[model samples]
Target: DPSHIAGKREYLYEISQKAFDMGMEGLMIESHYNPSLALSDANQQLTPADLSKLLDKLVIRYQYANNPEFENQLELLRNRIDSIDSELLEILASRAEIVRQIGKYKKEHNVTALQINRWSQLMENRIKLGEKLNLSEVLIKTFFQLIHEDSVRMQTEIMNS
Candidate 1:
């Protein structure tokens, strides 16, 4: 991400701090004895002294806290997340089954698996619904595109079989 930083050296420390806060165990920081004389990525390359100072300033957090109440609340929230994930997997399986049935129907009717107009409509509807649910449009579009691709692949397989 040195290129993305675009000579803003301060951002590197901020990003490293954020990564540490996000539970990253280690960071591969570029350093040199004389960064000003470095051939590549000189802007991002911190001198050894600066690197040491940056490392000292960074606060690494442990994954688990020692507080029992905090741990209990975290466990409860994690359990809820696990339950939701299970439900999501079940829903995806059901959707895949329905897609399989649709594939069979398409094969019987001699219809194409990919209908451009249908895909366009589906994307529009799904994007709007996702936005209403406070989800990012890009995330919804990418997620649905992946699902649609898999659905099309399934139908194509059925057609070939």
Candidate 2:
């Protein structure tokens, strides 16, 4: 994300760990001779000494692609994910219902689906909340934009039909 000063580095490390754990094909890191005096992003830059220390601490996990235990655990996780997906679908459906109601009101009042001011407020508020919740601002913004686009599309259809 590299967007926020506080969360960026921590979030970077976290995703790097996950990527390696999930058996990513390649990994790269930047290390400087002296991070404190680095030319750019000094705070995020790691000295070779610091990088070595971190590399020493990291445990390169096995892929476990064919391990029976991994398979079993994967199955259990998939089941849990299935459950969560069901719940998420229900929630999204409810949101869609609300969107439809809003569309109906907007249509009756001859209002446009696009509300730039409300969208701007949502972008700011949701992005701040997402950062507080340890989510990348880009991630939250992209997600909101997607849902907002879909809502707009459906609302437009409702108004037209």
Candidate 3:
């Protein structure tokens, strides 16, 4: 983070303030008696007095303020997220069922469950679609890999049985 901050003390102060305002419990700011002579991360290390000033400027925001309007809005947003999560679970369940059927078909036909070419093609298409939807490639790949692993495991079990 210091490398990213690149000796910008003002940016660090702003970021720290933002984090505090976002209801972070605590922060670990590096302070030294003399920052210029500090052995490591000299660029990021603030003098004790400077650190104290930064701390004083930080406004701590409470997670649960006694404001009815804010609480109500927060509750609404949380409810929406819960609804989306429920729908996501339902979709995953349906996908799992379809995968099980595919596993059965593969078992009956003596076909391998872990088809590398198909997986590679699926990943390429999925990454493209994910990028279009503004999703990270890492997230898409990891999610699909987990699903594929489960599908392979299920198919292997069916074949063994």
Candidate 4:
């Protein structure tokens, strides 16, 4: 879903301008017909007619400019990223099942729901590996935090009996 802070058109405009200045081709705006009837993002979705009007206004001000080489490079990078993203999703699904197994085992062993120390160690090791692979530390940390939180919740549910 696309999101921008509301009641801050100036801020959003500045951000969009910065992206253009940084060589982005254009913005990918989400538009829908009868946004009020949307199942999701009812508040954010714009009617198709309104969106068209907005795009017309924006197109007059924004020029389409890009280095020819940039498109090829971007396509190559996108392909590589898509491949890795598929693998990552598979691995995450496997990890979720493994967490479920761990929850069951912990129940049998009468262990406490969460092993925070072990989770901390796991995160530290993962961040180290991520660093070796050139991933941003902040991104790695945030990913692990969400995964750990969800895994703990799963474990908690199993332990509650």
Clash numbers, per candidate? 0, 0, 0, 0
Q: What is the C-alpha RMSD of each candidate to the true structure, in Å?
A: 3.4, 6.9, 4.2, 10.4
Error of 1 at 125 (Å): 1.5
TM-score of 3: 0.72
Quickly count the clashes in candidate 1.
0
Tens-digit per-residue lDDT, 65-91, candidate 1: 999999999999999999999999999
In candidate 1, what residue range of length 10 has the lowest lDDT sum? 1-10
lDDT of each: 0.87, 0.79, 0.84, 0.73
Best by TM-score: 1
For lDDT, candidate 2 versus 3, the one ahead is 3
Residues 1-161, candidate 4, lDDT per residue (tens digit)? 12354322323344555566666676654556776676765665566776665555552233443777877887899999999999999999999999989999999999987787998799899999999999999999999989989998898898786
Stretch of 10 with least lDDT, candidate 3: 1-10
Ranking by lDDT: 1, 3, 2, 4
Q: Per-residue CA lDDT of candidate 3, range 3-111, in tens?
A: 2354655566777877777777777677789978989877788888988898788778777879999899999999999999999999999998888899899988999
TM-score of each: 0.78, 0.59, 0.72, 0.56
Predicted candidate 2 versus true structure: per-residue lDDT over 1-161, tens digit per residue: 22123333444456556666777755466667986676776666566776677667666777667788989999999999999999989998999999999999999999999999999998999999999999998899898999999999999999999
